[model samples]
Target: MLKTFRISAILEGISYLLLFSFSMPLKYWANITEPNIYIGYVHGFLFIAYIILAVFFAVDKKIAPKKGIMLVLASLLPFGTFYMDRHYLKPLSAS
Candidate 1:
């Protein structure tokens, strides 16, 4: 489950970066919208997956409420999931 969460987290982060950095530029600057639309859908799916997995994992692991909140909050920031993977989820998996 942790491994699955980790994969989801990584994919979520990548999708976010792609949408924010690459797709958004293509949409507004160049007036190209298809890539943004596709990436947005993917990012939306992965973002939901990451949150659901985080909630389940938190419950299963009995993590602190603050930590669980951090998990959700991390999703909103660029590169934050990687930080959570390194500093939070990896330790949970090891335990």
Candidate 2:
């Protein structure tokens, strides 16, 4: 369970980075207007998967519903998932 969370967390982190980097060029760079459609699609899928994985982990581990929902929301905020992993998940794994 912990291993699954770790891998999902990493993938979620990378997906967030890709989304931010891609969005910058998409909005600001007029010269380089073309966006990587494939990357966008991949990140979208990964984002969904990451949320599903988080829910599964939370339910299996009996995490409170509110906390589980917060964890999912963290994925949407910049670097929030990293903070969640460090503070919320690390100690769970340690035990």
Candidate 3:
């Protein structure tokens, strides 16, 4: 479960980065909006998956409610999931 959650988080983070850093610019600045449409859908799906997995992991591991909330919140910010994975999830999984 932890491994699955970790992989989901990483994919979610990459999708987020791609949507904001790549797709968004292509849509607004380059006037190429198709990429945003596709990337947006992918990012949205991954975001939801990440949230569900986070809740599942938190409940299964008996993580504190606050930390669980942080896990969900991290998905909202660019690169935040990676930070959480490195600083929080990795260590938790190791133990």
Candidate 4:
């Protein structure tokens, strides 16, 4: 579960970056909307999956509720999941 969450977090983070950095720019600057639509759907799915997995892992591991909330909240910010993975999830997995 932990491993799955870690991978999901990374994928989710990448998708978020791609949506903002690539898709949004393409839509606004290049006057193209197709890529954003596709990327948005993908990002949306990944975001939901990440949340579900994070909650499951947190509950299974009995992580503190505050940390669990933080984990979910991290997914909202750019590069936040990567930071959480490195600082929190990775260490938890290592042990």
lDDT of each: 0.95, 0.80, 0.95, 0.97
**Global lDDT for candidate 4?**
0.97
Which portions of model 2 miss their true places by more than 4 Å? 26-28, 31-35
TM-score of each: 0.96, 0.83, 0.96, 0.97
| Deviation (Å) of 20 in candidate 4 | 0.4
RMSD (CA, Å), candidate 2 to true, equals 2.0
lDDT of 1 at 49: 95
Pairs that collide in candidate 2 are none
Shift of residue 90 alpha carbon in model 4, Å: 0.6
Total backbone collisions for each predicted model = 0, 0, 0, 0
Residue pairs with backbone overlap in model 1: none
Model 3, global lDDT: 0.95
* TM-score, predicted candidate 4 vs. hidden true structure: 0.97
Give all candidate RMSDs, comma-separated: 0.8, 2.0, 0.7, 0.6
The best-first sequence of candidates by lDDT reads 4, 3, 1, 2
lDDT of 2 by residue, 1-95 (tens): 87778778777887778767775477566545345566677778878988889989988989899999988998888887888888988888888
Alpha-carbon shift of residue 10 in model 2 (angstroms):
1.9
Better of 1 and 3 by lDDT: 3
How would the candidate models be sorted by TM-score, starting from the highest? 4, 3, 1, 2
- Which pairs of residues collide in model 3? none
- lDDT digits (tens) for residues 1-95 of candidate 1: 88999999999999999999999999999999999999999999999999999999899889899989999999999999999999988887888
The number of clashing residue pairs in model 2 is 0
lDDT of 2 at 17: 85
